[model samples]
Target chain A: MAFEQLAKDVPAYRAPGQQLGARMRMFERDKDELRKLGVPIETVELASETKHYRLASRNFYLPRLGFDAREGTARPPSKSAEGNRPPEVTFSVEEYEMILRAAARAQDLGHPSIARDAVAAVQKLSFDLPIIDPESTEWIVPTPAAGDSVILAVLDDALQRHKTVRLTYRSNEHGVVSRRDVSPYGLLMLRGRWFLVALDNRASAVRHFRVSRISRAVVSVRNAQRADFDVPSDFDIRDLSEERRAWELGDGRPISSVVEFDFSDAVAARGAELGERLTSGRASSRRFAVRRPESFVRWLLAFAGAARPISPHAIVSAWRAAAKDAYANYASADRGES
Target chain B: MTKRSADSASDQLNRVLIALAWLSDGQPHRLRDLATRVQVDERRLRSDLLAIASRTDDESLGALVGSRLSLDDRTVQLHLSLFRRPMALSPRESSAIELGLALIQHEWPRAEAAVAQSVRRRVSRLTTSPVTSSSNAPIHAIAEGMTEVARQSLQALRGALKTSRKARLQYQSFSATSASARTVHPFGLVLVRGMWYLVAHCERVRALRIFRLDRMVSVRVLASPSAKRGDEELRATLERGRAIVKGATERLRVRYSRKVAPWIREDFDVLEQEDGSVVVEHPLRDDAWALRHVMAYGPDALVIEPTRIRDEVACRFKAIARPRPRAAKRRSS
Candidate 1:
């Protein structure tokens, strides 16, 4: 019953079930709500008992979008035209093109629902113009693989419905497959993959599950109208996904681990607290509180001979064991073990 | 009510308003077609229309002030002058479009920023939702966090691409000790794994090079037009994954131990071994990438074949495991 018809003069209401006073009160309530939504609506009384409703200001509607030809150009204004002109609402073609391009780029970021919404918004904005296909091959974005898409679709539905999702997940450390029921909270796309931040029902802990590693997903359908759980206010998806390093993703206690980088690779470890600066002419060392020794060892191994783990005996021993195991694999293959 | 249900209720309201505005244009519209445009089923649309018509006075609400819905079997006619235009932009739509514009604005030129600002201001006025910055503040923070140098360089490169011209850049490569000047023809920009890279035909290398935008020290668009275009080639290269070097790619086979096999299978097509390990054949342009990849997983990932890569990784492992005299000095010191 909102914004139905507005004219200069409207006769008093006569037909209906509700009394005139009750209907007028409801109409007043609706008018207040519309005004709160930024609609500049005004009512004028033409007769003692009759009233007319109409949109009061032109600003209540979206202005016509046009390209400003004089964009980025400056000219000396005459005295007559200096202060008498009203501000014009217009956009440049460059701005429109940039918005269109960015919208296309965002659609490629791998979140299915956001991608759909982005395209829909683009369509609405460019309703008058020819539609630029967001799904075209011209835009090169790293799209999720087919397997990822299916998992994402399931997770998206679960999160939107606030349902518990049972996932058959493969752990990264041990390649172990296990089924767990979790309340899906939020999703984040980073490093070309989607990660679901959810609360594990069994563990009673919030955890990050990589969508790709989930082999199966079943969204709870019991009591479909009700939510299975509510996400805690303290659980922020950004804080959980902020861990950029592989070792930082672990939930265990942090262990102080020191790594020595050679003179050539010291630049790679520049951001960390430098124990021995590059100017020392020897190896530069830095310290890190590693939560997962296994992941840290693997990350250190990537540096090869240029970096060595110089830490609590456990870290060095783990690194050595990993290096020896890696060496043995190739050595065994060399001896026709394959 | 729960937040999800509340969101759905609000979403329904937006849909109804949009549908009403769409139908307000004095023409007969098919009920099914209107439902499709509003992203709702026909049954839901019919119910919504009935609900609106049921709670109306003689002069307002459903149909029109004077004439009510003239419902035929196929089409419904709405006689109303009000809401003849599309409804104001909803809150969520405004936020999404604002974020989209902010993305390019971070790397846009000064003149372009002015235009973007004007667009944002106009968009801000069009939204019926109360202006709340809290919902989208973090995303805008991330967009604005780009360094001034990178933003300027990106802006210059974008200008070059737009004009189909060459650009000169002082870029620092990962392997290089210092920045070097190079002229290149910009083909396109690719965002891979949250990092932006420019795929360009580097004049110095006489081939296409993927340059990280952040690695650029300075960039200037050249006036000369770059007649060559490589959109298809760039697409093919990116389709193969983030290729740093433009050349023939070699297929390198590596085996992931049982411990990481399940995780490895998530991203790659691999052959499962009887021992529960998985052998994944990955493409690479150089041995350096192979070395880093195999070494990154340590014992979990092992180079299976291509004796040269396997030997190189083995040699690196041996060197890392060997006790260094300098390492002993660190503990003593």
Candidate 2:
């Protein structure tokens, strides 16, 4: 087979009155699209002047996903290379639905970051994307908080691929906006804001980067699909964010901020997140290692007096002042005063 | 890369894949139906259909899925081969859903949680935990106090909102320590910083009241939609929420370490001092919250405010710091 013969054998299409060169360009463009979508095109040259072109069936197609009707449950399809071509990969409706349901659950929960990319990733798996109904009552969470959906998609991509992203981040602690190349560790939504816990390569420390503050249009510092560095095996995104609390995020030193909850109004997962054994034997109290005192106080105030400070004497006075302030506000509001 | 091209490529890829997924069901669908499902106009759908038909190399998607236009030209028919094996979710997709499920647990009614749990059971069967398979991203309820009673109240409120019925509840006002019977038209639920608030119209007060769901001990929703509409009130609440401080007059000034100061200043006004300390001036909304805010800073925050507020905070801290008889009994071993 000659190269000329192979080109001549290739299929040709001409839109009404389209020039031969233009039509050939269209064919070339279609070939590129197939390659980008992960289609494998192999060109075999026999001797100097002869060549052959064919689709690599084994290399190019998706393997199927779903349970065999006879099995009554999903079975792992053995992808044994039989003879001619490789196994094709494809997703069954059940597998596709499972992924979509998870994505829909994210959408209902007001987590756009998970919803957008999970759906996209699901398509990558099945090699197909399906539309989902937002109004479906199959599952629903009570409220939806406003959030930026794309940041999570980008960071999820970075994390999955283990890529470093050079992002312009606005630091809330210093009111300074600076750009840094960070290796994203993971994402945490604490205190109603999403923070990408990443290893700040320059500082050599893991830091919480508020997604809202990360400038839009974050750029990957390296070529796509290229890994510049590896996340340490021992590194955990949860470890980076499993700090004392969101209020204690930036504090350099650790201090104890002991507070007591009412016995009946206690946290269900008591002592689970409190790090160590409870210091007080009392059933109602939990102690936190605090760093940012002001943020702690504001957060504790939301408990609406159900919690009282146990060890920090200064906190009680602030609590009282806040109570009095609330009393005055309520009194005035009751009296129809603005 | 320019923003438009980057976005368009991703968007185009997503549309083509999604279309393929839908059409692969081996069913013939009207072009109108397909276009509506994908939320695209006829023109875009045709372009995407062309992309799919033209680029689906049999070496790739071609073997598993195929599509053709009907003679009428308005219907698209698909052909798909059965999958040999059950495809499982990727680790990242599973983890992403897991985080979402965890984050909304505060608002998850028992039924919804059960639904999520069942889905987790199915998905977990297929997923291998990423990395050492130990560490997971957690959604911690920073503001505690999600009790069973509060959960019951939440259930009732959810039913009320779903059915558009008015609810009667024993709700304790923040200023008062005792719970009082109140009838209200429930609007919707809002979870702020891990705390749940029920926005409703209070018939007794003749105003919109945002009741902390946890504050309600007993809740019952009865038949009958209220005369007042809830959507407007919810809209107003969300709109005014950004501008109005929780309280107008209850303001406090605290000097905090430079670190905590700027984060606070992200929301509240702050004054940076020559010594690198920052003073944050914020209104004291809820008493417990203000106290926790200050205490979260540990000793880094100092109250610089009206003498009464300062004295109250300092004295309260003193009371807590003092060792009680119960404490002595507990620790005397």
Candidate 3:
């Protein structure tokens, strides 16, 4: 009845004359008890001679204490007695400086997301601490390069809107920038570098672009609807990067194409770079099937004439014709110079 | 001081202070209101706030009075700066720091000094005696197996969660005879009864499933990822699975011996009661495995309803427990 009366304002209410002071005292006692239990009870004297009393919020009530540790103690320390003594040990200036250094180093050198979180956590710790030297630590994270900022922003926008993007990308060998529209799919960090996986519009295939090489990126207005491509549930990212060569294509359909390499050449020493696809059969011969033939041929030709195509007649013929054309072009250039 | 105790106190103090800072940002809080917000008694909360307020060079208790908290009426209003911070835990910032130091002290003595000293300095201002130690001994034991590779994987998982991106995980399942690749849009990692599980949408099954990390061979953050599962779909999947596995039944009834009655009563809801016996309404699928499970208990368990299940159990028992004549006796006699 007391709580109900306190809930709302009543017009021209008359209180019973008997024991009015006693009831008010009882209310004050209840308020005291509530305060001890961490309940925020407020009392407001209205202009119309009415008193408003209620809890500030539902959460103002503290949770009940289940177990008391002091109950089992044979001799609990007196609160006043324990408060008189100084802390057992105090941190020295040097020690305090070390903590600041460690925290700052962690805050600066760690990943941006992690560093920001750590700083907030440490700041909370500092609130309880008596002394801290924030400036003592020289740990500073380098600001991200301009190129990284551009790439990250574009990737972020594309992901948010689920839109394709057009990028001006320069190839590593050609160094020629070409505009390509791609369906922005995912971003990966491999070997401390970032790569963007997107559906390449020109090739009509999924291709990976190193974010560092991308000079410009623009979110395309056009939405290309394609069959929903689901990433396989069990795909592992570390396996893709941890292998001898980074396979950006993910778990693609297994393709078999034969390649022959001369075992007598220096190219044999570079077997580790060839990865798991190449197999050494005879002492003088190495037979291998390229999993990704397009990417593997450029890697194989780095060995010069030592690496030869064994099968896939078209690849062998193409390599042979390229070699002959290169020889004739060089001979003609020499005659012109003479 | 034991490194573990120091670190634990520091962690507790940090969480408490963060909570306080969030509450103190908007308005001044009355003693009682502040205590309620911080979930401590007025006296203890006053001491803690004084301790914190004393450390700061700018703010004082007077500033609190000028803003939202008023002692005259005992009303407190809170500011809204409490929800802006991002929360993360690292090895150094984790509760395991002290345990890691203690364990590493025995094997890697050289590194122990730095770890122990660091913990000591950080927690010097807090109360010296350990608050709770024995309760966390088991937690330390578990942290022993967290290797660098596992830590890296956990970090990557956290990053992927923040970005809301799908992760390509190379998972090896013990149930699977061989390792298979999978792409998963990871939802969250839950620690249930000491085991870690990643609840995510499995691309292959196109359904939400939980994968035990202990059974996970490796985890990777893929470059190409998919969107996270929507909230409605996730909730519906979990509800459906729970209903099938543990939903209440309306018609099924079973009788149990007095010895097994208590166990049955505790396990299932009771439908009816009679002299020295009770009938329970248990929802179960009509399957071979369910019939076999009912028969395993023998005479201790009996089916009271659904004549088909009772006949099935009896037939299954006869097929397994029947006596057989020896071939030798027939030939020699």
User: What's the lDDT for all of these models?
Assistant: 0.64, 0.54, 0.44
lDDT ranking from best candidate downward: 1, 2, 3
Clashes of each: 0, 50, 19
Candidate 3: true interface contacts recovered: 0.01
Candidate 1 residue spans exceeding 4 A from truth: A1-95, A127-138, A157-163, A201-205, A219-243, A250-253, A266-283, B1-83, B88-149, B214-217, B241-250, B262-276, B324-333
Q: How well is candidate 3 docked (DockQ)?
A: 0.01
Tens digit per residue, CA lDDT, model 2, A238-323: 45433246556742465676676653433312222343447557655677776555556656654434567666766666555545
lDDT of 3 by residue, B59-100 (tens): 333243334332334544444333222122222243223222
**DockQ of model 2 vs. true complex:** 0.10
Top candidate (DockQ): 1
Candidate 3's residue-wise lDDT over A21-63, tens digit each?
A: 6555555555544342223355656676666665432233111
Tens-place lDDT digits, model 1, residues A131-181: 333322233455565576677778866775578999999876556789989
Per-residue lDDT of model 2, residues B235-320, tens digit only: 55542123222324867778776545545654555688887778877766655446546654444566666545555555554444
Q: Which TM-score does chain B of candidate 3 obtain?
A: 0.43
